[model samples]
Target: MTTIPRISLSGTNYEIGYSHGSSLKAQIARQIEFYYGMFQYSSKLDREGVHSRARDYEATILKLVPNLHQEIVGIAEGAEVDVLDIVALNVRSEIALGEFQDGCTSLSWKVTGEDGKTVQYLAQNWDWVRPVQQNLALVEIQQAEKPTIKMVTEAGIIGKIGYNSASVGVLLNALRAPPTDTTKLPVHVLLRLCLESRTAAEALSQIEKYGAASAQHILLADLSGAQCLELSPIKHHYIYPNSDNFLAHTNHPIENIAIMEPSQFPGSKERLERTYKLVETMSSKNISTKQLREMIFADGENGNFGICAPEDMCKPKWFRTMTLFNIVTCLKDGEPTAEVVFYNGSTDWIDPQNVVTL
Candidate 1:
């Protein structure tokens, strides 16, 4: 593959969604196919069942964020697919539950510079099955009232891993434990809401208000600082950076919350530990983006299941997960100082990969 498609969208919510859907119609179909296969293999849920769950989420989103709902509608119309299909893609986390596991490591580091300014960074390795790798898209949305969003998401899904013009960024890790409540907004929709916010606090408020449909870990950071929201269907928890001024999250929950479904990915714990161990070697106050990149690219004994997961052919299709892409965003203290880097291609950090800087 050359590089992931980079799409720039600007207009009303429906127009933006229409552009996204029409521009990526083929990729969106492929995304639907991939998710359908995963749903069947992981949870025994057919397309009908997935759409059934999606309908409830559609109603909830329409009730809560109507403009976003319009966007979803536009996507369906533009893609020439049912609206529920896009909704199914958006709410895949809640629908899959613990049956389908996604392995991702998220990190946030905040350092006080010599000039009494704070240098904050948010980064993640988006790990998933290999088949969907080619379906991923880098989407930038320019909305009317909300801040502009630049996110890397699966073709049909609107909300995902990305940062906004306001310096508010979000990283997602799907949790295994869950009692999914279809009455609330799904995690992906909540992610879009967070990205629309001007600050991390506003994002938190949105989560608290709409609540989550299932369990998810959302690592949120802004110009001020960073905080991890460990959201369960019923209750939520927060994880802050340690005294070292750095925080890392894997697939497991750091707080003492009830886990209904045991995690299938055993390497989550190891990856979290490994990330911390790697951070130990870097200076907290002077951590550079290069150091952060090295941290995500650290692949060793946990090859098939490391922080940078590599696909294992021996494993079943659903179990074959690898790092799809990596994104790192830095919010500094000056004009035009904000930095966003996206890495796509081979896991080898030394390889000549497609790197995009914005």
Candidate 2:
């Protein structure tokens, strides 16, 4: 079975990070190299420039979530890399802004069972440059006084797409926009903060208070329902599921207020519309996790820019992006059930052995 490495971590924030770094030292180094190259190619920034931006983001992280800052410090110590390198990894989205077009399709489905129980499912197809897929790690974090978090992130990044024991799950869609706020929490850090919250409301409240550093869309869902937080440096908006009880998002900004560059990924609109149509047709029936996976894996509508992007689909092969993984979290009564399918160079293949349940 082809699978991504899964690391289980428990203890203080620093200890969790230390374990992550020590266990995945080589992967972290690879992530740094990948991002450094991406920084230069996408944002035209050198390593020194990237480090300078990372230092500014570091101050914001310290002020907002000092514990996470300590975790980052511990990661650097355990990995034997400079703290700035990890910091740069965490804030790579902010530094690059809209230059690197990493496309994704995210959705949240809320349905009520015949027994009057409500269940919410949050899922996404994480598309990115193929090389970084090797560095992906499924990290399970057990912290004191916070929800247990199971997330998939690049080796050095402290925060990313994941859910918690509190039944809150978040899916990310990177928006290609400018004007990042250095004083505010970076988008990835905000994702970690949301995972720490016990409820969706608490996550939204915390995000509003800390503010967002970049323009991105976070599709946040709980057992109750879900809301898409369309966040930018200057403004933010919340988009809930439709009357049919589901919402979908892609790389483009849904709201017109924010200034965003034209998406380099061509099929954001096509994918978003296609996802809506897929769910609408299934509204009369039960939506299973397997069904959701099928919907996410549907391809060829826009060829290379389809929902399940293929590497050869993009011209100038260096810019090719492919789905690295598809994670679906179903939040019900006792616990939230989640599964991740780590891509193995095929769009529609979902081997049972490749699925990791959390």
Ten consecutive residues with minimal summed lDDT in candidate 2?
Answer: 310-319
Model 1: per-residue Cα lDDT over 117-219, one tens digit each: 6778887888888878778888889988888888888888989988888888899987888688988889999999999999999999999999988888999
Q: Lowest summed lDDT over 10 consecutive residues: which window, candidate 1?
A: 335-344
TM-score of each: 0.93, 0.95
lDDT of 1: 0.80
TM-score of 2: 0.95
Kindly report which residue pairs in candidate 1 clash with one another. none
lDDT of each: 0.80, 0.84
Kindly report which residue stretches of model 1 are placed more than 4 angstroms away from their true locations once superposed: 112-117, 335-347, 350-353
Candidate 2 root-mean-square deviation in Å: 1.9
Q: Can you write out model 2's per-residue Cα lDDT over 227-342, one digit (the tens) per residue?
A: 99999888898888888788899988887477466544478888998887777666524667777787555554676677776776534433578777888888888978788887
